[model samples]
Target: MKRYRFEDLPDIIGELLLKMNSIEKLLLENKVNNVVADDDLLTISEAAKLLKLSVATIYTKVCRNEIPANKQGKRLYFYRGELLNWIKSGRIKTITEIQLETETKFNSKNIYK
Candidate 1:
């Protein structure tokens, strides 16, 4: 590290502040982008791509009301959060999880007896 004299301190501090401001701007932009992405409205094709399913399947699911979506006139839109939640809702419990749940239920029943 180069030792800075008192004269150079002001310049060094100014440069640091400029760099910090640039970094702050970049961070804020990134956060805004992430927020927008989370709430983004996705078309049928985009939803299909995100869910790794065919567009036709997405349409069928929408028709059956199995997937969360919004219909605006002739257009169908899905929220990224809703799609992610739908995926999460369909998750199958593991055997261990089921066993633990069963055990908890049985124990609670015994306690109530």
Candidate 2:
């Protein structure tokens, strides 16, 4: 990060605040009901809507450690970006993809038959 001059600090902060307000306005206008802020830690209900799952299901996954979350006392919190990435990581491979992987494994010749 570049060091900022103390003299110019207020101007820089004001500009950042304006940009933040602009971004907030745009987000509100778009009506993005599921995920709102850039770094919002979501509640169980919010997480369920974002993931298209039920609140009970989210609780179940949290208990089973199948999903990523932070447990604070009795509360659960999830990061929106991380949850989206986790959902992406569970993608199913097609038949061709499985065949290609199998072929690659056999071609490597390092495995014991």
Candidate 3:
């Protein structure tokens, strides 16, 4: 092992602290990135961007209970999965599906005759 003079060790100590501080910063950033990449809840602006709607409109929907979301304290939170599911729930039936349903209804009426 190499030994440093007592006075020289102070400089080494400062450098070590700076390096440790930098490493800690990097670790914190990585943790934040991981949380953001996961299926975490999103803010109103984030939900707006994901849904391609105006923030005002989002607020309105939340007010009238037209959108699926939660209010924690005074802030709103949305799950990306639930937003996608809400979009899916608004899907309109295809022409073929409408036609099939009509036929089934008519056939059922005939059977009852």
Candidate 4:
């Protein structure tokens, strides 16, 4: 290790403090990410509330295999992320989006022809 002069001690300490602060921030961020990634499973009623549907409707969807779910014996569970994705999959395209898609398809076909 290189010898440090008295004048360099303060600078060295400040650098060390900055590194520690950055490491702490990184650790905290990782913990938050882990918590979000390991979200709790939702029961049928809770899933219904999240989806703004009735419990009966949730059960019907599960029976029809229209929604993603898990079953443990008689208990039903849903992943929040999967439920959110299921909602997203039913998204209706806006008029502008439909027009853009039509234009792209027409142009591509014309190019091939």
Candidate 5:
């Protein structure tokens, strides 16, 4: 079995969050409606738009507990602020490094020796 670490991915995810925050700020300064409401609650579609991710992916994250979300009766809602903070936490940072380590381990195996 191969183990993967989440710390291996670059800080690209953090950069992406900063970019998104910048866009949101610019939109607010330009009097364009921010994607998230003042209360910070967003529907799945709205969050997907803000994250530039597929709704299915968002739902998957929600299900996997990768993102913070709560159900209000039958409605599932996510908090924009929480989502942004979560992204800033760099959960994907380990991916690339873990993959590299696994590859190196497999290559170092003495299958021919």
Candidate 6:
């Protein structure tokens, strides 16, 4: 195999860092809970975004059994109801849902209602 020049190392490192940063950002923004539980499941990355925390922090909380999580194979999922309950239970201090929006029970049809 051919060796890469020392000058190219910086570019490679920069690209890797950029990719990592993007992944971090994606993990944060994808935490939205607009989808129905029957529609799709939220990943650990999404939970981090929803909670406005880092992915590593999410894993740490999961490992400590502080947050509600479901593990399937190599993937972990967070249910909307369980996550909300976890926040209400005060297990997760950073993840907060706006309770003042409406005082109504959420079914499969309307959550924000």
Which candidate number would show the highest TM-score if scored against the true structure?
Answer: 1
**Which ranges of candidate 3 are over 4 A from the true structure?**
1-39
Candidate 5 error regions (>4 Å): 1-38, 91-113
Off by over 4 Å in 6: 1-40, 91-113
- Give the higher-TM-score candidate: 1 or 5: 1
Q: In candidate 4, how many Å is residue 44 off?
A: 0.8
CA error at residue 52 for candidate 5, angstroms: 1.0
RMSD of each: 4.7, 11.8, 15.3, 6.7, 18.7, 16.3
Q: How well is each residue in 1-113 modelled by candidate 5, as lDDT tens digits? A: 76546784456577888999999988777664454343488998998998899999988998898888888887778888777878788766478889998988988995974
Clashing residue pairs in candidate 4 are none
lDDT per model vs. reference: 0.94, 0.90, 0.92, 0.92, 0.81, 0.76
The prediction achieving the highest lDDT against the true structure is 1
- TM-score result, candidate 4: 0.67
TM-score of each: 0.69, 0.61, 0.60, 0.67, 0.46, 0.45
Instruction: Name the better of 2 and 6 by lDDT.
Output: 2
Error of 4 at 47 (Å): 0.6
Candidate number with the higher lDDT (3 or 4): 4
Of 5 and 6, the candidate ahead on lDDT is 5
Candidate ordering by TM-score (highest first)? 1, 4, 2, 3, 5, 6
User: What lDDT would candidate 5 get against the real structure?
Assistant: 0.81
For candidate 4, write residues 45-108 as lDDT tens digits: 9999999999999999999999999999999999888888899999999999999999989998
Give one clash count per candidate, in the order shown: 0, 0, 0, 0, 6, 1
Name the lDDT value of residue 28 in candidate 6: 67
